[model samples]
Target: MPWAVLRLHRAALAVWGAFLLATIGMLVWEAGINADSVRDRIAACGHDPGLCRIRAVVDYGGTIGWASTLVYYSFFAVAAFAGGALIGRELENGTAQLAWTQSVSPTRWLAATLAVPAVLLVAGGTVFVFVFRWAWAANRDLMGDDWTFNDVFAARGPALVAYGLCALGVGALAGVVLRRSLPALGVACGVMYLINHNLEKSREDLWPTVASGGSGGQFHPESHYWPMHLVETGIVLGVAVVATGAAFWVLRRRTG
Candidate 1:
């Protein structure tokens, strides 16, 4: 059953592998070539406005910024794949039903589908998180990003992996409920977007804000990145668990 699942989703797995490789390559380039060039440019610039305004030096941050943004939002791609390719297409095309009748019980089939992708998602997300954390920290002077930044916060820790797992769960639930590929893809993406958007907005509140001074004081967390991200990760993982359970329950009801 696992082998059949792997065979069916080999294309998706390949695409995921390509994405992982591309992200790793970009991180390596940023940490090596880009970092060195930026350092040289900064040294040359010193206090010279003209040297500081050089295109390569000025644009370095933006170039690497986009790469970080892509890595941060990679969960959306996972959501789309899960909804469209993993579960939805199978249900829409009657492949799932075909498998069910051939010595593969519905629950076991669902387990195989979710488990395989869960492993892949965690592995890929972990790599991105570690690489991104290193790159972001190492190139702090070259970028304008901060711990409070939306993409940076999520990308720096387990929150990124949690988001990917949550997306998978949401996608699976949408696929099972809709039983159609295209609609599930659309709905799952939309739902995940909403969840992410709202969370990004409220993330600061996950941990209490601290005031550093008097009346006109600055308000921020004592530790901005990890604490808030950890809280948000817990929330996202809770959502993933609920969605996965619901998917299993619904599948059992439908098949039984």
Candidate 2:
């Protein structure tokens, strides 16, 4: 079943591989090469404030920001794929029903449908998190971003993986509930956006923020990164578990 799933979704797997490679390559270039060059140029100024040529910093920061943004929003694509192709299309075309009528049970089919992509998502997401964290941390002076930035915060930690898994579950639920491709796609993406947006807004509330004296607003210190990330991850995974359970329950009711 896993092999069948792999062969069926080989195109998506290829696309994911290409995207992962390209993004990681871009981060490597920016962090290892472009950042170093920018530092060298700035250091060459050597106490001459007017001679400092750091124009490259803007370009470097922008590239990194773009990468972070891509990683941050990647869950939408996962949701869309899960809804429009992985589960919805099969249901819409009667392929899933046909499989269930054969030796494969509905529950097992659904498990195979989710397990393969979930594994790939975890593996790819982990690599992306590590590489993005490295790129973001390298030469912090060249970056205009901080730990508090939305894209940076998620892309640098386990939240990215959690988001992807949540999207997968949400999309699967949407597909099973809707039993159609287009509507499921729209609903899955919309639902994920709502959840992500609300979470992003309320993220600071997840952990106790430290107050800066002298009229500065309360803020999270560097130490808050893990606590906040874990909290959000827990929430997202909770959602995933609920959605997955609902999907299985719905399938059982429909199949029975």
Residue 158 of model 1, lDDT score: 89
Model 2 clash count equals 0
lDDT (tens digit, per residue) of candidate 1 on 1-256: 7788789888888888798779778877887677887777667766764656455544865665666678678778888888888889999999999999999999998899989889988988898878877777676667664567777777778888899999999999999999898998998899899999999988777887777766866466536667788889999999999999999999999998
TM agreement with the true structure for every prediction:
0.92, 0.94
TM-score of candidate 1 versus the correct structure, residues matched by position: 0.92
Q: Clashing pairs in model 1? A: none
Query: Pick by TM-score: which candidate is best?
Result: 2
lDDT of each: 0.83, 0.90
Off by over 4 Å in 2: 43-54
lDDT per residue (tens digit) for residues 87-131 in model 2: 999999999889888899999999999999999999999999999
